[model samples]
Target: MEYTEGVVKDKETVIHVHPNDYEKAGNSYLMAIVAVIAGMPLPIINLIASGVYYLGNLKASYFVRWHCIQAILAQTIIIPFNSIAWGWTLSVMLNKTEPTLYYGIYLFAVILLNIIEFVAVINTASRVNKGENVRWIIIAPLTDKLCSKKNKSPYPLY
Candidate 1:
């Protein structure tokens, strides 16, 4: 009777242990897959959006230049960093590793970049609303040669 009881108790313990192990293994596998899928899209999306914005800005109408420039700048600096951070975090999580100090630095850099970008965007918008020139707000300098004034007749003699 004692031997049978001990054997039954040991079997029960083994059964309990096996289920816990299986649960942990299943969770780990799920987490790894989720991390990879989540991380992979970020950089690709950033690249595509930035490229499209940059190209669209190249031929933007005069009235839309300010908004286009703001979009371009946001895409250029903010999106890429954001994507990198996501990728880094996902990689660390998938590897079951703690985030390093560099992750904090990357986060800080993203914040600072965003703040600067916000200031730039606000300044550009204010200037545009006030009917001031906005060429300087953009990354590239606008030349007088490219101005509409030079391309049109000063008087409506025609």
Candidate 2:
């Protein structure tokens, strides 16, 4: 294996293990657009649904109970709308008849949206993993010190 920039290439074919940054950035932008177009509706729906649930069912803490209810509401609303939009875009693209300008634009938008979504997910996942590792590193020692102070044990198991 040979390394070029941050990418590892196969010795025989020179195929890169990591994609180029520009490509990744382009994908990330697309993902952000998809998130905005497809995902923006959910938060509003969640707020409404959670508000209703919180008011109707007053047994649990509104803040804590609303989180789960909001997630469910968001999923229910987002999935069906997203699926219909995706299907409509696909059908227009796959149609055998002469494609209209608007159809072409719609197809392009859907493809671009998906690409953007892929990039965003990749970037977010990478950042989250990095952040989580850093957090754990910082937290572990603090947790140990707190536990040790409370229990009078120098070594914390966890």
Which one wins on lDDT?
A: 1
Per-prediction TM-score: 0.45, 0.30
Model 2 residue pairs with clashes: 30-116, 31-116, 31-117
lDDT of each: 0.43, 0.37
- Cα lDDT tens digits, model 2, 1-158, are 34343332222333222233223322222333344455553434333443454344333321222222332333343445456555665666688445678766766765576455446445543543232111123333433333212222132222
Clashes of each: 0, 3
Model 2 misplacement above 4 A: 1-82, 89-98, 132-158
lDDT of 1 at 31: 29
* Per-residue lDDT of model 1, residues 1-158, tens digit only: 11121111221231111222222222211322233346544545533543454354343332233334334444455566767777777888798667889888887887687567556555655554443334443443333223232212122111
The RMSD (Cα, Å) of candidate 2 is 18.0
